[model samples]
Target: MTSAAKPEADQTVSGQLRRALHPGGWSLRGRLLGQLVALVAVACVVMGVVTEVGLRTFLLDKLNGQLAGSIQRVDSPIGGDQGQLPLGPPTSGRLRFLGGGAGTAIVVIDNGTVTDAYTINQQNYGKPVKLPPDALAAMETVQVGKRPSTVDLGGSLGAHQVIAVASDRTPGRVLIVGLSVVDINSTLLSTGLIMLGVALIAVLLTALAGELIIRYTLTPLRRVAATASRVAELPLERGEVALSVRVADRDTNPRTEVGQVGSALNRMLGHIANALAVRHASEMRVRKFVADASHELRTPLAAIRGYAELTRRSGDKVPPDIARAMDRVESESIRMTALVEDLLLLARLDAGRPLRRQPVDLTQLAVDSVSDAHVAGPDHKWRITVPDIPVIVPGDEPRLRQVLANLLANARTHTPTGTTVEVAIAQLDTGEVRISVTDDGPGIPPSLLPEVFERFARGDSSRSRAAGSTGLGLSIVAAVVTAHRGNVTVTSRPGHTEFAVHIPSED
Candidate 1:
């Protein structure tokens, strides 16, 4: 079945190709253009034919009228019974060739007997009354009248003129005066050939001009693409590009699309320059942060190692004061471990590692975190407000729990023993679960609000009151919410401070 279907598909495609290649169904632009030109040429030829035929008909009508005048001039015969008519002075050989004339021939028919009158071409002189079939056909149908009639002979000699008039001087019922139009046809043919040749040349020239127009019109777009490709190839890590790195804007013609592209490219280059400068500043800040973090960790680790060595060497001889110092060292070492772990978690989050996500109830998470904060610092009044209805949000449950716990813990460490710490979870109208931890503590100064989410940024750096967890609690909150495609906002005032986490609902 598959093999049969494949052949059927191939046949269908081949049939389409055949249709596309048909005389009236060209598929390519070039082929279509050629077809259009051919149609125009054919139209020109048809128009020329119509024009030539009309002109010939008009001329023949006039010529027959002139021939009728010639017949009237032949009034009386010079001799009797011979049917020889008197030739006028400007008679037999008197007819002059009209302007660019070739020659002429004449034949006369009388009383059912034909007589040759004159012929410029000798082979046709004095021949039998062999009229063109068209002329003869016209004669058979025409009545004997003074007015001449014209009949197209349908060759080089387009039409022959014939007139029948009363001739009392001749022993004949009618006088058939006819003429051949060989010279007139030859002139018409030559003129038509010249016109067709000129028309073909003009069409060719027009097509060439059109091609150049299409090329020049599209040049600017090509330049813009090339410049963009070269710019894309540049290393963004390089701190700054010299002014020499600019692309060619001179070739851009502003009156056209190319010109607009040039203008846009210049603007793009400006944006790229600004972006690179910002990136460099960010890299410097990161380097400084790393240096500061290493220095801070080294001191604590060295202190712990030194104390451990002293304790091991002294054994029972070490004084109570030295033993207490060793205990302090162990406690500090544990704090350092916790700080390192927090830093590592923050680093992973910054690097965009996927966090564990599930449907977590923010209200319940807030309660649990507040309870933990109250136990951690029994002196602080930790208050939590959870909605009656469970407000469910998509997030990592532990991380959401940790986020509230860290904020409450910060409140405990910063404020005095009896400061009220409030955690609230409420659903906002914009399909988000809003969780805010507000503390009646000394608020963040206006100057530090912008950089509050930066790594290791802290409002109060006092040794005794500094918040634990590597000073990245707010930063982790920001990163986690950002990963969930949500937002974290902070508003702090002297007697009121709030950090809100707006996690989007799963629905």
Candidate 2:
């Protein structure tokens, strides 16, 4: 590799390693398992490297000692002066004097020229084998008096640990001794393979055991999550809610990490339940107050209307202003009575007072409501579309009729004269009877669409109070529809506004 390319390669390898250690989008459990495995792998690699290095060092030291002994025996006076043999073919006699075991190579050099070179043939029971010229030439590079050196003498001699020394008997003669390190290399290879296999087995066992332990430890957290999910699915926004869901008792022990979380969650749920109970109690009290106040005001309002009418017609000619004042009083009393009735009805619906349920034909109800709207607002165009067959739904007849009447009244009061108002009733394929009131006037403002059915929700410009809009008509429609187990929705844009109600069919 070129020098400039080396950094790029190193960066690539480092990036790969970093990504493997901290992969993106890993879940908590996956990250934990990966860290555990990576730790074990690093420890195993370190152990293998240390074991191989230490074993090679010990083996090499022992081989060097054997090399020293071979040099002592070959250079001994018992063999011959200068340990020099005849400059001829290597013989068994020379092999016996070398003393080192098989696979030892020795060379005799005289005055910078090789005189004899041979190695012991281990396959032939320690017989001497003459070294090739190339192998002898490779050994000649070992420096004289050096401690030790490793030389690769190619062609079956392989690598050898060699040392050279000058002759004491002859001034110019040199002795070079080498021993094959093939056995050391083979031993190291075998040990490495064994260590690798054992490390892999250990890692596999650790992974399995760690996974089991983690899953068992997280079981309580899973249960806590399931409980929270169930609670989330409950209808806790309205009415009297029974917030009964809670973490299991064993899971909320507070002794473990997940247990601590579970305990805190249970405490939070308990507080919310208490708050919901309090809110429901407060709402009930308010509803009762409104219902009682409305019931009590009926008698006094009736008396006021009766007295004003009686005073206006007492068989005596009265001033025009006084008569007109009596007329205003009667009209206001009538409007106030209607407002009280609406409030009482809303209170009863909030208290879950059961309504009379019977199969009512929605087609007939739509026609009647549209007819009443036409009579009330004769300047506006009114249209009704209903199926030839009566589409019946199980609900309170009076309440359903009131729902249609309010929807039509809302369109008539808000739209300009001559604006078309349509009433449509049909049975849907989903076993629902749908009633829709659509108008082609200046549609409701987009800001008011969300809370159009809320109590006292009215537009400021187009739907003014001068139109006798108390802002409770739509609220009454919503309450009555909800009491009958139906849904109401409205959509409005420039030039179009629609109110749709869907009630489940009896069938």
- For residues 1-507, write the lDDT of model 2, one tens digit per residue: 011234343358777787666667466677777788889989999999999999999998998999888777666654565634432354435322545578788887879877668787577577666888888888898999998788998977789999898876667878888999989999999999999999999899878987888778778888999999999999998999999999999998888888899999999999999999999999999999999999999999999999988987786788889889989999888888998999999999989999998888888888888888889999999988889888888889899999999988888878889999999988899888888999999988777777788898999844466656688999999999888778998888767888989888963
CA error at residue 239 for candidate 1, angstroms: 17
Q: Please list the residue runs of candidate 1 whose C-alpha ends up more than 4 Å from where it truly belongs after superposition.
A: 1-317, 463-470
lDDT of 2 at 19: 64
- Top lDDT prediction, candidate number: 2
lDDT of each: 0.65, 0.84
RMSD over all Cα atoms, model 1: 17.7
| Candidate 2 global lDDT | 0.84
The global Cα lDDT (0 to 1) of model 1 is: 0.65
User: Per-residue CA lDDT of candidate 1, range 9-103, in tens?
Assistant: 33577788987667666533456467556776787778778878987877777677666655544433434334343333334422222211122
Clash number for every model? 0, 0
Candidate 1: pairs in clash: none
TM-score of each: 0.44, 0.81
| Model 2, C-alpha of 49: deviation from truth (Å) | 2.6
